[model samples]
Target: MFKKLKDGVNSLKKKVEEKTGIKEEEIRPEEIPETQETDEKPIDKDSDVKDKKTSFKNKAKKFIKERKVILSEDDVEDPISDFKFDLIENDVAFDVAEKIGEDVKKDLVGQEIKWREDVGKIVNESLRNSILNIFTSEFEFNRYIKETDKPVVIIFVGTNGVGKTTTIAKMAKMLRDKDYKTVLANGDTFRAGAMEQIEKHGEKLDLKVIKHQEGSDPAAVIYDAVEFAQANNYDIVLGDTAGRMHTDVNLMDQIKKIKRVVDPNLVFFVDEAVAGSDAVERAREFDEAVDIDASILTKIDADVSGGAAISISYATKNPIIFVGTGQSYDDLRKFDPEWFVEEIVG
Candidate 1:
């Protein structure tokens, strides 16, 4: 999915080596010998010769300890620029790309590189740490759900066609599989067939669905679901709201109303991984409007660039808790930052 970013990193490695004449492999301390053999004297029993050898060993040790490879500003300038362009071309937000470039420069410029160290590996590690820094909140989704109190209310929000409804169903199935009594609330009464779609999933999963007629107030449906969960002892309530673009002020306001009425424990913003930077912008806007607790990216398996997955959490300052991998009830997978970095950089 991150083919472009990976290629760009490889290019950066080559450029660094080309510009600095530095080999990719690092030199180890043990590789340096303590002394060199001399043809002048083979004094096997001479104490003076032994003392000379010891002195030579100490000098060599000191030299090796003091030696370090440092990259100058000019050494990294061109490579960082090229890599920044590469990130932007791959749909990374300009600000994010710039931040990565600056971070790489900070880590590499004037930093010591072992003589036999893999320069590429060092750069890659720096990039990985920089990217990981962008993730502010991370948690195990299943554990969080299980640990929360009974009838935990989770509201799903996103733009149209990001697979919000289907993702909700997948989440419901996930909870149900864990033996949590779940109920689906179709708060998306403004959208045609939204109720029917969620109801169909409910039937398939043998889970109950709470809904109201189309055009009815969305908040009322959620309120009913919450009350029902309280009364009937359901373990979780997965509420689905109507999909709307960030530009739709009215629909955004409706989401705000739902948030007010439901007081959900968690609010997830659903998006498509293929949406790239657009998804990041939408996440920002939605978060501004409703303060989303986390994100759920859909169609990740189909996204080639993987920019959205990389940038959304960073841009919105929210963690991505789950990802929709395919078109199945069990396709939703928990997000792992380390696994994602490995997939992109390994």
Candidate 2:
């Protein structure tokens, strides 16, 4: 697909060059005027010049219509390099941009493009596909999800303000709508509004949420939620952990303790897609704290230019299980690779 676009642009460049030469050949430097008996003119130099100029104009117009130039790599000192720099400005990693530029060049070098078309379009599509392909890397979420017979606990873990609780709520809503007997564990006992935010979603979904008082032990809250799910008939339990800096060892240890208590079926690392490379760095810390079964990419709808969605799974080696498209529960998507590819490429 990218090759075709590059070829078209190169062809346009060639045609433009050819048309310029043809136009020059059609024009004359001097002209003669027509003879007029009344004026006693020997020749009409001015009239002839005007006629030739009009002729050249018509020919040039025709040439422009028939021929267009397709820009080549040699036509510019560094076309793909400039494009890569633009990508970096858009928050794509330098290394990732370099790889994309190489891929674009490889696909474009030998291709034949049509005249008058912009090669940048090809570059854009190639870059888009390259990024979308990262999100498309598949994994078996059902493997971990179906392994447990009792209440399958899923702990949502991430740094502070990364939409961890909201992602938990979205998951709970999904499970509830599927008739999975869902329970939400508000284990984020540190944040002031964390419990309230989670409870709002729980109320909307009508799912039972277990939350302890603020400043309580998050691990104990998770333990109680697990026990509650087990005692009841709930099939799915989603525990929300307090968000903190990835570098904070104390908070990391707290999450580790919670994982020990719940033995969750999947430890989901929720990160905002707009955070770019920072999202990848945070994932590393969170994954080190617990056995993360998968990842959930949040705020994708507002993060069109960010590459975090593309880079996170590649960095962590954890498959993206879900993508949050918006704040509503219905906005949560199951992270279909095909759909992602289609939407992004189109």
TM-score of each candidate? 0.85, 0.72
lDDT of 1 by residue, 56-123 (tens): 44434543665555788898999999999998888789888899899999998997765556778988
Question: Residue 4 lDDT in model 2?
Answer: 26
Candidate 1, residue 50: the lDDT equals 74
Lowest summed lDDT across 10 adjacent residues in model 2 is found at 29-38
TM-score of 2: 0.72
Report how far off residue 40 is in candidate 2 (Å): 40
TM-score of 1: 0.85
What does each candidate score in C-alpha RMSD? 9.1, 9.2
Backbone collision tally, model 1? 6
Q: How accurate is candidate 2 locally (lDDT)?
A: 0.68
Question: Clashes per prediction?
Answer: 6, 28
